[model samples]
Every structure is written in structure tokens, then in C-alpha cells.
Target: MGGIGIMIAFFAGILGSLSASDYSQYTYVFCAVLVLTMIGFWDDRKDMRASHKLIGQLFAFFLVVVLGDIRIESFYGFLGIYALPISVSYALSIFMLVGLTNAYNLIDGLDGLAGTLGAISCGFLGVWFMYAGYAVEGIICLGMLGSLMAFLIYNWHPAKVFMGDTGSLPIGCFIAVFALLFIRENGEMHPSAVYKFHAPITAGLSLMVICSYDTLRVFLRRIRRGKSPFTPDKSHVHHFLMRMGHGHDQVAMFLGAIKLLFLGMVIMCSGLNEHLMFPFVVGLTIAFGSLINVVTLKRMRAKVRKSPPISQRYPIKPTATIKSKSTWEDEPVLES
Candidate 1:
């Protein structure tokens, strides 16, 4: 429903030309999203192998680069690495694009989990773009958000159909592309109209931290365990919640809400006060740290509960072997 609604609205927006960038935005996202949707939808039904999916993603990424003219211009001062050579930026951009696609796909296990969170993230991003005066990127975010909102109609709790890899992969990739477009280049600042806040890149990262962090953590854990990172398992945060007695619906809601809460903190500070980026970051760090502590405590409690008590370790001996004596006494009486 949400997906359909967005599709309709995008078409309508294209027809009406609500914004100058709407046309280009719709066309670019439409083609890429359609291809991704088809590939993902098919993969969902028929189970496409990892190799095939990777190939498809590469094809999609190349298409965006060639047609949409998407490229990574800069890192926004995060790594102390500024202007990259053209070739390196191109390579890095594609990598980030594909990585985002898969990150969302991997996080799409529970109902309303991926779609809802994606909507929230994109909605925030879309508004930020509009506020920053990047109308094209803003429109892109809004269009995507609208589509995902429609998808959630069927994707919420007791989901009728999953978004599968088809939806997740493309959506993720497109978002990365959007992020690339939104970031400022080395020594090339955006126009004053585009941003009313401190830094664009930090805002982008904060918005996407949930998906990025989960993907990074899982990838590292898999590498450390000498396991294939592509292999699927019940290791996601949502899965942990499920194992810890959360119902599927509850898990989905919890993950989405947590993501929103983080973004909300960032927005409330950054948007309202306009100089609270530092405080926003600090607050997020504290929240995430506390979350980790809670999860650790739950695991410890579960482990302790599953173990046997000390009394069970040593069974008491029987008080007497009276059955044998009774049998002997009865036998003697019978004989007499």
C-alpha cells in the first residue's frame, strides 16, 4: 500500500512538475528501483545466489554512475582525507552504494523493520535536503520515503509479503547514492540555502548509523569467527530480541523506534538549537552504550537461568535399601 501510494504520487508529481528536480529524480529512481525490484522480487521467490546478486548490484551501480551521474565527491572531513583522485572516488562511491543496498537487505528480516526504519531515515533526510536547499536530493528522498511507506502496508506485522532482496537491495543502494549527492566536496562548500545546520556529512552519518553499525558489527563478527559474511543466521539485533522473548511484531517495532529515537535526538538538537551537534553525538554515544549494556545483561540472565542449580549437581543417596530386606523376610516366612 505504501509502495503503491508512493508510486502513484511520484507519477503525479512527475506529471504536475511540483518541483523542477522532481522529473529527473523520479526518472532516475524509477528505473533503478524497477530493476532492483524485479531482481529482488525474483530472487525472493526463486532464491538468487550471492554471486548472482552481487553481479546484479554491480550492474545497477554502474547504471547509476553512467546515467544518473552519481559520484562520491568527498568524505566531509571524517578521515582527515580530503579530495580523492577521481578514480578512487568513483571506486569508493560504487562500493558505498552497493554496501548500503546490502546493509538494508540484511536488516530486512523482521516485518516493518526495514521498511519503517528506511522511511524514517529517508523522511528525515528528505526534509533535511529540502531545508538545506538541495531540492533534487530532497525530492529523491521524499520519493523513496513515499514508496517505502506504501510498501509498509503489507510489510507491517503479520506481513502478507516480504520486500525480499529485490526491494531491500535497491532501496539501500539508492540511499547511498543520495548520501553521496548530499555530501559536500573538498574545498567546495554547498550553497548557503542547502544547509541551515553545522555539517551535512555528520548529519547523514547520524541518520544512517543504525544500519551502518549493524552491518559493520556483523561483518566484523563473521570475519573474526572465520565464517562467510554472506551466510544468513539469527544474529541480527532483531533476532536477539526474538530469542530474548520478544514477539516478531514487538521486535520490529522496537528496532524501528530505536532508530527513530536516535534520529530524533539528532534532529531536536541540530534543528532546534543549531549548534548542538556535539551534544547530539555525545547523547547518541551514551544511548548506544546503554543499549549494549542492556543486551549484555539480558544474555547473562538467560545463560544463568538455563544452567542447572548446585543442588541438582549432587543427588542425595537413598535413605535405605529396605526393599531387599522385606523380600528376604517374606521369603523366610513362606519357607517356614
Candidate 2:
């Protein structure tokens, strides 16, 4: 179901492009991703292994580099980093492309979670590009948004199908490219501009906060316990929520809501003091932590409800049959 929606969107975008006649820079983007999307679709049906998917991501990222000339322009003032050298840009971009692609793929555990969040993030980036006059980037973002919008028809509550790693990997790669372009456009303009209004990076980071942070947290926790970070477990936020009694649909909706709220708050706070972003990040972390505690309490309540009384665990046998001695002389208590 999700695959069909993506096909329809791809065709619609192609038709729109043909009608325009005047080819745009986004033509390369659409063409480059066209093959990758098919590969993902094929893998979705065939159940590709992790190594195969990793190789596919490498190939797709190379396509972006070779065809689209994709590169990371800046670090957005983090780590005292500014412009990246050519070699660094190439390396970093590849790593980011693969990382984000898999990060989103990992998060596609519930219905509507990955698809809805992808749409919201891309839609925001599209608008930001329009304001920044990056028309090509904006069009690419619109194309992505369209694809996700179509996917959501089957991805919503009571989902008929999952996006699988196939759909999610492409979605993640698409968003990463959009963010790179967004940063390149404004990051190349002026330091002040990059600092003042970095809606694209902020939006992208905000949307995938749960996925990214959880991934990192699990990695660290696993390393601390001498375990492989890649090992699967029921520790994911969605999994814990399920254990806490949230239906799959409810968990998906709750996660989507959290992403949107965080995204909105970040957008609203972009113009505020530099100190504000830190506090917002801290607050969100706390909120997520509290949510986990609530889920824990819910699980405790479920355990309590499921537990049987001591008598049920170990039945006490009837000791004897008795009668009132005064009422019936012949009816005496008989001990068992």
C-alpha cells in the first residue's frame, strides 16, 4: 500500500516536471533518487539484509555526490567549525547520508511514525527553502512531501502495510539531501544569516529527535554494559510504550505529536537568545525522560492487574466438613 502511494507520487512529480518543460536543477535530484527508490522497493519485497542495505546507501550517496554534486557546506557553528574542506565535506556528507538513512529506517517500527514525521520535516524545510530562494531545493522537498503524503494513506492508524527499511531508507536519504542543500544555500551567504535563521537543520533535527537520541542513548548504554549497540531489544521507546499498554496506533500518534510540538517550538524560538536553544533541548530531554517513567508506571499497573492472589498461586484444600454440635448431635465435625 505504501509502495503504491510512492509510485503515484513519483509519477505525478514526473508529469509535473514534463509539463513545465523548462528543466530545473531538481531534475537531477529526482533522477538520481529514481533508481534508489526502485532498489528500496525491491528490497522491501525481498527482505534485503543489513549489509546489502548499507551498500545500497553507499551507492545512493555516491549518486548524490556524482550527479547532484552534493556536499556539506557548514557545521552550523557547532564544534567551532565553519566551512568544511573539500575532502572533509565529501566524507562527512557520505557518513551523514548513510547514518540518517538508517536512523529513520530504524525508527519505522510503528505505523505512520516515520512517514508522518518525514512529511512534517520536509514540508517545513520546503517552506524555508522558498523563503531563502532555493527554488530547486524547495521543489525536491515538495516532491518528498508528496511521496510521504501519499504513503500516509496506508501508513496511518490500522496500517495495512509498513514502510519497511526500503521506504524509510529512501525517505531518510531524501531528507538529509534537502537539509544539506538548505544549509549550503544559506550557510554560504553569511554567518549571521546561518545563525539567525537555520530552520532547515533545526526542523530536521527536531523531527528525528526521538529516533536519533534513542539510538545514541542505546549505543552508549550497550557499550557501558559490554554489549553490541546493534543488538535489537525491546528498549526502544515505542516498544516500551507497547509494554505500558499503548496500542500501536496510539503510540504512533503520540510520537508524531511530540515531533510536531518540538518542531514548532524550535521554529518559534529561532529568533530568541542564543542561550534559549540549550534550555529547550534540556527541557525536551527531561520531558522524554518523564514520559519513560510514566510508561514504567503503566507497566507496573498492568503487572498488578495480571497478578493472581496468593490463594490462586497455591490453593488451600478444604480442611473438614462441620456441623453445629448443639443443633444436631449426630452431625459431628469430620476432619479431613
Candidate 3:
């Protein structure tokens, strides 16, 4: 029953707005995410294969990029690159869509974590879209925000329901779409436009920095350890906070604050170039993650030193539950 409420609320809002002028232009986006939601729903119940899920994700994203004509057309001068070739644009767009969809799913660990973060990002983007004159896209964001807020009532600590793959996949896909749109639209804004971003790419990345950074860190660690990147483990940022003795609600609030901190940094550095702002954001995130890791490790070491010797201690039984083979369905496995 993951995100069943979110789906219902979101669709109902979309339906209510169908009569708005020129709203049909965004119908493909609606359709694309709808397809993703269905795929996720199927996986939630039937435990779809990883490869099969990837195929489905790729198909949905391709429909949006190729048919809907929504994509990253330029690098925003990162690495001194501006516009991209058509083939490169298509490849980049699809890769980002699929990567982010799963990256978001991977972060859906603790109660209220995903839903809270989703609301924050969507709320920010929704306000910006409305102010920037993207009414349809803004409405989409608000619709998501509304659904997530309602879902959070039941999804708080001691959660009654999880978003699972069903909610997270489409939500991630939806956010990725808006992020790309933000970059493209902001770049094309008139020089005098007040709401235009000086570093659109950086701002877009900031909206998703937490989940993106965690996913990259987890994958790199897995590769360094000579294991599949998708292997399950307790190495996420939320896990680190838990190891340091934070409650579920506290961890959710802390991560939410980190996200807002990143957004604040982006706003404060609005005058900087994308190349400069990009590395600054990445470095700040790395520094914070490293700090958390060091603290967590030190605490664990201290606990070990205070415990009885291994030879004298009673053997402890494993309390971890056995997860399924389906990576997308498992509790600990990385979906991306």
C-alpha cells in the first residue's frame, strides 16, 4: 500500500486542473510519471527483477525525453561546455532520470525521512515555479507537496505506511523532471528577469543534494570493497546518525535541515559561476559526511572498549531480518 494515498491525492488534483488553459502541454510528463508509478506498483507486489525494473524506468524516461522534448540541452558552461549534441542530450537526460529515480528510492530507509525531504524539495520548487511563471509545472509540484504532507501524517515515526518503490520512484522521477526543467527554463530567462538563477545547474543539484551525495558515497564504498554497488548494507547517512544514537524523527529533521542548509548556501552564493558553485557544494557535502562518519566510528570504538572481552562475552544472535533477492523490494539493498 505504498503511496496509494499519494497517488490518489496527486491524480485528483491533476484531474481538477485539467480544464486550465494550455495545460495539455504537460500531459506527457503526467503520463511518464504515471507509467513509472505503475511499474513501481507492480514491483512492490510481484517483486520485479532489477533488470526488468531498469528497462521499465528507461522506457518511461525515454518517452519523456524523446516524445515530450524535456531534457538537459546544455551543461550551463560546466567544464567550459555549453550546448550538447542531440545524442548526448538524450543519453544524459535518460541516465539522470533513471539514476535519480533509484537514488531517491535508496534513501527511503527511516520513517518520515523520504516523505519529509520530498515535501521540502517540492515545496521549494513549487513556489519557484509559480513565481517564475511555470503554472503547470508549479501545480504539479504543489500537487506532490500536498500528497506528501498528507502522507507524512501516517508516515512519521512509527509509520503506518511506507512509500516503498511505488511512491519514491515516481516522486524521484517527477523531481528530476522539474530539476531539468528548472535548469533549462532559468537559463533561457531574460537577463532582466528577477527570478532567474545565475547558477541554474548548481541550484538544481542543491535541491537533490542529500540523496545524490549519499548514493554516490555508498556506491563508491561498495566498489572499493570489491562488492556489487547494489549490495545491501547499513552505510547510509541515516544509518550513521542512528549509530550515533539519534532517534528516527531526529535523523529525519537533521537531514531536512542539511537540505535547507545546502539551499541557503546556493542562495548566498548566487553571484558565483556554476563551475565554482558546483565544486563548493560538492566539497561542503563531503566535509559534512566525513564529519558524521568520523563521529560514528569514534562512538562505536568507545562502546567496544567498554564492553566485556569477546572470549568472556555470550554469543549474540543476529537480529537482522532476511531480505528478498529483489533489490528494489529489499529493505537494505540499494535500488539504484
**Best candidate per lDDT, number?**
3
Least accurate stretch of 10 residues (summed lDDT) in model 1?
Answer: 185-194
Model 2's alpha-carbon lDDT is 0.70
Which segments of candidate 3 are over 4 A away from where they belong? Answer: 18-21, 308-336
The 0-to-1 C-alpha lDDT of every candidate, in the order given, reads: 0.68, 0.70, 0.88
Determine which window of 10 residues in candidate 2 has minimal summed lDDT. 195-204
> Residue 84, candidate 1: how far off, in angstroms?
1.7
Q: On residues 134-198, what C-alpha lDDT tens digit does candidate 1 reach at each position?
A: 67667667877877777778777888867667567767776776766655431255334334444
- Best candidate, TM-score-wise? 3
Expressed as tens digits, the lDDT of each residue in 1-336 for candidate 2 is: 265467567557846754454345555555546655777787878866768867766877877866678778667665567677878888888887777766777777877878877888788887777676666556657777888887788778788877765567667777777767755664455546643444434544565676776667667778888998888776677777777777877887787787777877877876653245655665776678567868677787878788898889999987766657764586554655
lDDT of 3 by residue, 168-264 (tens): 9999999889999998998777767878887899899888889999999999999999999999899998998998778999999999999999888
Error of 3 at 121 (Å): 0.9
- TM-score to native of every candidate shown: 0.75, 0.78, 0.90
Of the two candidates 1 and 3, the one with more favorable TM-score, higher being better, is 3
Q: How many residue pairs clash in each candidate?
A: 11, 0, 0
